[model samples]
Target chain A: MLKLPSVPGGAPPRPGTPAAEPASLKDNASEAAISALGWLDERTAISGTARWVMFRKVPKGTNWFYTLGTSTMMAFLSQVVTGVFLAMYYDPSPNNAYESMRHINNDVFLGQFVHGMHRWGATTMVVLIFLHMGRTFFFGAYKYPRELNWVIGVILVLLTMIMALTGYLLPWDQRSYWATAVGVNVFASAPIAGPYLGDFLRAGPEFGATTLSRFYAIHMLLLPGLIGGLIAAHLYLVIKHGTTAPPWIEAEIDEDLRKSEA
Target chain B: MPDTSKNTSPYTADRNIPGAFEGETVTRRRFMTGAAHATNGIAVGMIALPAIGFALGPNFKKLEERWEAVGRPDEFSPTEYISRTITVVAGAGETGKTTVYLRERNPDIDHEPEDEYNQYIAISTRCMHLGCPVRYVPASQRFICPCHGGVYDFLGEVQGGPPVRPLDRFYTRVKDGLVELGPRFSVNSELKRFSPRDPAQDLDALGQYLFPSRPTIRKIPGT
Candidate 1:
């Protein structure tokens, strides 16, 4: 029941006239795109979901600050893409890890660029996620019915920190090695369960052969799956309960309702 | 309506279900559901338990006690320290190796009780604060940690900084004309030897009981 926009003053020719009229290339392209989308929508019956997700009724006074969550997601997506490529060349063994990184920097095409994106994107994601958290806090969006979402957000922040910590050791250079040593020792500094937890993280009492591989598995496989699942839940809750307007936006009183109450 | 609340009898037939056997206690449907749940639980446990054990098995595994000979006894002096690279973990190339400062035991300065393992003193470079490698500077006669500001004097006791205890030491013995370093052992403020603990785990008072030694690495028995 959908109609395409008609060409201005370009009505169909009479049946008796020559059938040489051609549709515009733009019109043909749009028609093909729309038909492809329509065919997919028919088989999947997904138009309703698409409309529901895309055409959300955001609150009044939604501003640029609301985009911080999306920005953070973009940063996370960059990290995921670049991390996948980096893992293709990275060696997780203690002996070859540093050498493989040097190879990535020197030999692989656009390796340093992608590696830099992942490195800097990690920082960007942390910054943007915190900024998004700040926006939610300052705007009082974490109150009332959205408290579960806030808790989930806090957990996501923790998982992000775990991602950062685990990813830092994958390079296996001297800085990464010593930094992880210090970091794991920090874990061991705890009173009761510290030593066991350190062993778990390092896969042994000392930073043995398996530590880099363990960190790689944690960083890429375990954490990404957890973060992806949590992000889906986060967006679901966000869509379920629409965003809050800025606190400065007072509720507008309806004159007719006021008169009726009076 | 029937008084179903009163139907607490053990037999299913007493509940008056259609086609219920006379002596049947549980219905086939309930039994099947319970069996299905039990089977699912066993299946899940079969996969999950082994996977968890694979990751955590190293924590409970005891490491092999290794003693590597650093050098001859004449190479070490009591006044100054000599560095020797020793392998703590096997199979790992450079990461497994750590530098130990070795010197002959000075009778006046070394006050710990003399034993078969104390002929030469071997000090672990691992800082007591957060496990960063501390470098011994001959100029100041002080061990300085580059990561943190932990400082230790010639005796490897905490002099000034954030180190919780003294630098850890290795058990040493003279065997076949070569000075060999044995298993690592941690010390308290009084330099009393306990089991080998990770750096930053204090051994003073309740600190020993609080941060217990791992089963993977330990000091020699009766030491």
Candidate 2:
């Protein structure tokens, strides 16, 4: 029941949209506004903080490829803002599911594009997540303590696929139908949990109205809820362990020796 | 709020990284120094291969589900069975595909509402046998897999061959003149339910006709 915030004319912005707009824009409006928080007032204050705690220095030759992760995060943030716009129009019902999509596609403001973005965003998220993992692997970032984060990340990756799977079925279209069929077949590999999992997903052995409700709950409520938790743990670990160092760090073993000799 | 005396850096950083503290102060100019400049062209070297990979393959759409449209109940003829190819639309450039059946309602045909006039059954074209597209032989009133001669009845119930189960069906219903299909799912058992909890009749192929639970692969000695 999270409502989008009311736009001046459109539906209210979805609650919790982290839009950094006019507030920063209006702050640039006048000299008085600029003076109100006098730049120099805190300029010197910024220098007083724990330097290491407040900032970080790069290794002498780290690569810019690291920017992809940063950009990917920016993309995810963009998805969050747009996703809020989507949830407002989506109807969590077996009956109205298709129409709800149609509404989002044709009726809501930028509905078609927002839905397109969410759909594409999902595809992008999965791809980016893999790219991120591959980058880590090639960099040997998964060799030590970082492996735990990678494992957690593996869980996140699977969770992301699951999120897409469950959300895919929510549309209640043929694509969802057959694709879920094939998807459930993957679980059949679990032996004991396979059949039951399949049954659980299809709602008594065949996808039907009840199955739609089931997928909807998982897609909207269960997944985001779980992802939020996992991501929290991940972010905490990331802050604790820090970004993976470049190959040069390991390569520097000889350089540090040379520098010391010099 | 004017002091630069108390800040401390976290990293024992090399002097090149931007946003890193040397002692207690960080200058944007320093932030964008050697660390940023030194490796300006390296991102392409690192991430290009994966970027190219993303464009050329299916590596397969790990995403479960695509899209299928429901046909209107009116579009179907009551007596004539329609084996309409239901096209599924999926983004990311996949050619989505599926099939749904629409047949006439014979109220007096002694079946449940699910099997009544205009039963909408959206099924996959793949045969439960070794995965071949099934063809509905209208004359024989059965689904025949051309690959290995596996045969199925109208409901995709395996009549004879190597198929383990019936052809899968996407959930089907009629609304707003469109026969809406839900996310595709396997229709293994030939169980039928038209109305929820309040079914008009108990219907099953075992009850209605000679539908085999599975088609056999072993040859009969003398048939």
Candidate 3:
């Protein structure tokens, strides 16, 4: 019989050593949870995958600036939550738009507070994203293998601005009305397809019901979906490329270790 | 110095530091690369300009405030307040139907022919809190917003609830025996006085605390 290496606590018998009996659960709550995870791992390798993604080692010099990306994500999630709540009471019609906003501000439970949070959260996210981008640029984190991520970041910035613009008209207040009018007219000034594009956005020659509905759809649905995809791609690239180190520390590291693989 | 000779892998060792490569001077190549990037950036921006302009076209349009004729002077009663719906042309050719509360102020004082305009008090039916229409309650001599229970006395003063200021008033003019409504003036919450100028300009002291200014386009003569 082939003599296998001695197990830690099992007896190493002479030629006919039978395999040691499998260990049973320790009859404790913690042991039960561990055993349950072990059972899951046997089928799906869940623990291994979790360890690979969640517990992977980051570079030594990663600092507080690294948290900006997570902060932007948190801000986005807050927007989504607050937006959904507002959407519940929001009337996407020209007739009811102002009234519905009034209802939300005055009547809905914590409505004004949540609405304020969403508005401020959007502004915060925009600021945080730019700061995050600035950090990445200064640290030279967008070099070589992460160039695509930089491109994606630019796209994200544009998408965020679009999100803001589309949402600006939702309240249908005087400010929103005039602001949206000015915003759409800027699009109409484009050289060749400007008129067509303006018509498409406005849904008519003038600002009316269709314009409100279209902006509402774009703000609530289309932009969010596109941004959600971009965010996923951005995060995937971050994980694959690994977080970049600070410039000073990166200069000291070995060249081979410094250049992350694509 | 670290041993440079041992680090022979072209992909890993050469491209580690940004713009650093083996056997080439960094400055010239770096400049060329930067120029190329700048050129590409300009090209992308040029392409994006029209699309961005198209997206933000509404923002560029001029906002205009036009005086709309609501009703004749005789239609309003001297004894009680009456609510009348009038279409107001807002920015970009969009019209909003708003309620105007019309009542003859100081019915006891005989009005002179020229001062007929001063006899009428035209308060916006829209609540000061969030723009919900306030209904005039003759029983309690108050205007109440059904949406929020905000009470405004017959003069459009906020008697109770979350209204920061009294209801906004229309800049009214009596022309050809008709009440013509011009732009709205915002009321100072503390002073209880309406600022005749644009709210944005008048409430500069509040600094964005009051309603945002709806700047009307200053129409120039003959293009």
Higher-TM-score candidate among 1 and 3? 1
- Candidate with the greatest TM-score versus the true structure: 1
Question: lDDT tens digits, residues B119-220, model 3?
Answer: 577777756544455788889988898756888876677799866567767656788778877655555544333333221122335532332322222212
Chain A only: TM-score per candidate: 0.87, 0.72, 0.82
* Per-residue accuracy of model 3 over A1-262 as CA lDDT, tens digit each: 2233333454333355344754334424444465566566767878776776677668879999999999998999999999999999999988888899999999999999999999999999999999999999999999999999999999999989888889999989878876666576556444444444555677644466658988998999988898889999998888888898788884455668667742
Task: State candidate 3's DockQ.
Answer: 0.03
Residue range A1-262, candidate 2, lDDT tens digits? 2223322354344466467644344333543443433444345554444453346655554677666555555556666777777778777665677779887888788888887888888888888878877887887777777778788878878888888888787666656765675566555324334444554564443344556777777777667777767776766666667666787665446888888999
lDDT of each: 0.90, 0.57, 0.70
Model 1: per-residue Cα lDDT over A10-113, one tens digit each: 34554664557676677667766776676677678899988877899987899999999999888998999999999899989989999999999899999889
In terms of docking quality, how is candidate 2 classified? Answer: incorrect
Which candidate wins on DockQ? 1
Residue range with the least summed lDDT across 10 consecutive positions in model 3 chain A: A1-10
Cα displacement (Å) at residue B165, model 1? 0.7
What is the lDDT, from 0 to 100, of the residue B37 in candidate 1?
100
**TM-score of candidate 3 relative to the true fold:** 0.50
- TM-score of candidate 1 to 2 decimals: 0.93
Best-fitting candidate, scored by lDDT? 1
